[model samples]
Target: MNVELRYLRALVAVVDAETFTDAAIELGTSQAAVSRSIAALEQALGLRILQRTTRSFTPTPVGERIIAHARRVLDELALLERVAGDHGSELRVGYAWSALGRRTIALQRQWEELHPDVSLVWVQSNAPSGGLADGSADVAVRRRPLTEGRFTSTPIGAEARFAALAASDTLARRRVLRMADFAGRTIAVDRRTGTTSEELWPEESRPAGFRPVQGVDEWLTLISTGQALGMSSEATAAQNPRPGVAYRPVRDAPPIEVFLACWRDDPSPLVADFIRLARAAYLPG
Candidate 1:
């Protein structure tokens, strides 16, 4: 039939209240209006749904069957509304390990204050590949500039690699070191996981006899033992400079660029707000 939801709601209210006046009060309408709605609903369905006397209203056998199904439909509509509202209000943010420093955390706090309606979730990854491709995250902070055409990126900041060595190491005496200084040195490199090509020294260019370490923690241990030196981003160097470790800038090395990346198709307001905060926090005046 062509009956609308309002008609069904009116029918249920009338059946529950057992009087047109009471149903009108429940539906926020006049008694006459409620009666007209019921009459129209009956005409559309080609069945008398209610039995009415001056003192009372009662549901017919056909009306009882329809009311059961109508209640189910109304419940489903309420659930659909809630699901849509939740999906519209939530956002997932992703970042590389080096990207989640004090500054980025502060930016997240500021963004939340400004957009209280949107929920911000933080995700961390070591890979340069942004998480949007796999849907693990909605927005990402990538250390290496994104080459994937599917994502939209904004330059956040520039990062650089620094050599970390034991203070007793000979290279530690220099104010800064060049890539060539690493020649003949037993260098520790992260080879176990998330090693992007840019983070690696080309096989031909790497120091002869350099050893690859399997984990970040293992690399740190190797460096601490005074047996090997390792390279890390400036942010990581700043955070974890041990007593025996010296951090020096790596001169003549290509700079690592950081970007805020998001799916090209995501139209979430929360993502937009976070991007705005990141630009303000990282961009130079």
Candidate 2:
């Protein structure tokens, strides 16, 4: 039950090499050490696993069965190590709403093909810093400039802004909408996670009032019921399409800048690489 893998390995080497001296040479150990390893293996298991004569080394019937089982166990343990190693090397990326939208799958696939040593995992948190503020994520895909001093960020790409409207709203009929058109409407705003603010409009043209929401679900739900109009990075339109809401281009609005955020100090080793890979992923197609 407590046998060592090295002991089992030594036994297999002796069988395959046909002699303890040969196995010792292959293993870069002295013949006495190989002999001791096989003896220790037998003693640990309370069984004689080898039939040895002066000039011949063979396996007893039980030795044959144990050897097969040892090979299987070693192979399975090697596989387990790989699975564990992959999980340890994983990078967890947090986001509030959309994770690169249309680019998400491509990013994953390309990162895998280019660097198979690490894996990426996505977690969603509705905070403006994504999950970076909490311990839920190691790095994040954020749309706004992160003001938190604990984090540093780099711009990856910019996505056009879009207005989220009730499907039945008049603006939905327009091929493209403008900031002026949203005047006089209630704005559903997620101050923590979203990039939109009344500052995007002139003081006189801002929405009538702001209805605060904690997350995208509430923002979308309120928009669906025509309770408010909202704006988000273009990725949100592609990543989350509500059944009762429509997305229209905010032609005059400034594009939302997407950023890769990480701890200002002691960031993960993978963070910079992830940022580079992400920037490349969003390159114009």
Candidate 3:
């Protein structure tokens, strides 16, 4: 079967955007073009890749495998283009949310001073692997480590947990909070990319309810609106300071461990250097 790169791109865009209309907007093409690409791809593969319903679009089992490979291929193709075009060396570091919080700039500056020949690029992606699995980044910084064997992870540093509440909530007055303090509140979480989970608390005293959100913005919105509270790493507290939302240290909660990860078979040469600098950046001066 002759499968083109545009077909793969269309497949990924549709999946990421969750609809052909949105995928078209993302790809700068018409909705009909996106639809045709998907159909052409399916015809070439001779199998159903996506399950579409009135409410949602999701990948079939086989489509999931195909999409994963597609991401890797597209990533490699991008690298090839950069090399062929003589683009200078760059290390793309991906993160789902804040990249090292307040230390992001310090790390970037240090990297530039040490390796002026190579540009340090930060790519923000909402993927669970922080863009590694999707091939958007050469390396990734994550609070939740990837379990896939194809990936290798290194521990960089840990940050204390924090509680996020509506500024007007009575609990917002506290200077610090404990895990138990959240037991009575509804907790908002981004199950895909966020570090927090209901399991953090003892089963019996867990939050009143766990509401899953799509991303950090949604999580913060829920907290800020008094619809729910949230738990996250100190990095989040430092990186995102939304109005109507108050962040307080969760004194008794366990610290959130940070990790640097990359594909094991084709790891970036700068991964080690990046890890060393990241660790130093996270250090208390």
Candidate 4:
């Protein structure tokens, strides 16, 4: 097939993003353009690449094979570009729980002022590295430090931890809390992206148990219904804002560290700029 790299990129973006519209958002193009790119690609190969249903979309048997190869090709291209010291016009900022939360808007505005030629795209993933390890993001912002030798990073800011409770809960009226206050509570925590852990408590006084939630929305839903309480970074409160949930400062809880990380071997010039911007944006007055 005479497929071009851009066409393959669009195809993979669609599948990874899970919709034509979302793929377009990531690719910085119109949904119609992304749809046309897929259609043209299928025509070139004489095979359908996607199977669409009313509620969702997925790759077909043939499409899955194509997608796998496309991803590999794109990854190689990215590596090549990185090695060549190319900071492309677009940068994808990946995150899990929250992408700088209340700082997001100011950061974006300042980023535009600092680098008007480059476009920034925020991509959310619940992966351990916020999709950086899987090549879905060029760089990532996460609360966890990058421990692997392959990655290098700097701390941008630290967010104060908060205790999330149902609005009707007795604790909701309190302005602040301590680790000891959560002794008998069953707390909901996201296994993948969350920074909170039962370890915050002493062995004997840890929360009654943990309710493992895979995503922030699920954590909020569980907390809202009083099935579980949650302790999380202040960013979670600023970003999610569920009606039934209230976030109070955890006076004695440890703060969550935030970092901007990228592959140490890649040498992407944009990573430095991102790290710098994040630091400046998050610095307290």
Compared with the true structure, the alpha-carbon lDDT of candidate 2 equals 0.80
Instruction: Give the lowest summed-lDDT range of ten residues in model 3.
Output: 79-88
lDDT per residue (tens digit) for residues 210-278 in model 3: 998867888998898999999998889999999999999988899999999877766445777889999
Q: Give the clashing residue pairs of candidate 1, or none.
A: none
TM-score of each: 0.55, 0.67, 0.80, 0.71
- Candidate 4: give the clashing pairs: none
Which candidate, 1 or 3, has the higher TM-score?
3
Q: Quote the positional error of residue 197 for candidate 3 in Å.
A: 1.0
| lDDT against true structure, model 1 | 0.68
Query: What ranges in model 2 sit over 4 Å off?
Result: 1-87
lDDT of 2 at 217: 93
Candidate 2's residue-wise lDDT over 15-122, tens digit each?
766778656644557889988888999999999999889988889999999988886675555445434533586877989888999899988997788678778889
Clashing pairs in 3: none
Tell how far residue 263 is off in model 3, in angstroms: 2.0
TM-score of 3: 0.80
Which candidate achieves the best lDDT against the true structure? 3
Candidate 4 per-residue C-alpha lDDT over 102-167 given as tens digits, one digit per residue, 9 for 90 to 100: 989998998889889988889887656576655668889988887767577778889999889999
Candidate 4 residue 53 Cα shift, in angstroms, is: 34
User: For all the candidates, what are their Cα RMSDs to the real structure?
Assistant: 21.3, 21.4, 4.2, 7.5
Q: Which ten residues in a row have the lowest lDDT in candidate 4?
A: 81-90
Q: Pick the candidate with the highest TM-score.
A: 3
